[model samples]
Target: MFNIDKNKVKHANLFAAGLALGTVGLKVLTSKDAKKVYANVVAAGIRAKDSIMQTAEKVQASSGSILADAQEINEKRRQDEALFEEEESDEK
Candidate 1:
């Protein structure tokens, strides 16, 4: 007493068969092309990453230089202020 609908079962089987055949055919047809496309994509990604890394390094170096220059200016200002205060005290 299997309460299965015969038509529905037939339709399901046909769908499964078609899907399997299509997948196999596509893989056979495009495996080589897929590999080549994948390689190209990987190469492009590597190049993009390398370029970004170089730009980041350049930005870091420039920021360091800017910070060093600011520190030098601050130190010079401090020294000048100290000398001026000393001169005023001597006058008094």
Candidate 2:
């Protein structure tokens, strides 16, 4: 007479259930519908990236313009200061 442990039987049943669920999950993930969803997600991500890059380019261009304007203003200020100094020296 063979004695089967109840705990062993319960464990075996649980293992079988887990295996079945894993197989079904694999099948669903590999289905055509899932593939289409994945493709759409990737396409959307690419579009978002392009939009962000365009915005970044615009910002970079604007920053360069701002830096050039600042430099021009500083140069003008320096020239005015030099002229004022020359006038003061001529009077002394």
Best by lDDT: 2
Q: What is candidate 2's CA lDDT for residue 20?
A: 100
What TM-score goes with each of the models?
A: 0.68, 0.77
Those runs of model 1 whose alpha carbons end farther than 4 Å from true positions after fitting are 5-30
RMSD of each: 3.9, 2.5
Cα shift from native, residue 64, model 2 (Å): 1.0
The lowest-lDDT stretch of 10 consecutive residues in candidate 2 is: 1-10
Clashes of 1: 0
Best by TM-score: 2
The lDDT, on a scale of 0 to 1, for candidate 2 is 1.00
Q: For each candidate in the order shown, give its overall lDDT on alpha carbons.
A: 0.97, 1.00
Q: Over the stretch 1-92, how does candidate 1's per-residue lDDT look in tens digits?
A: 88999999999999999999999998976899888988999999999999999999999999999999999999999999999999999999
Model 2 agreement with the true structure over 1-92: per-residue lDDT tens digits: 98999999999999999999999999999999999999999999999999999999999999999999999999999999999999999999
In candidate 2, stretches whose alpha carbon ends up further than 4 angstroms from where it belongs are 1-14
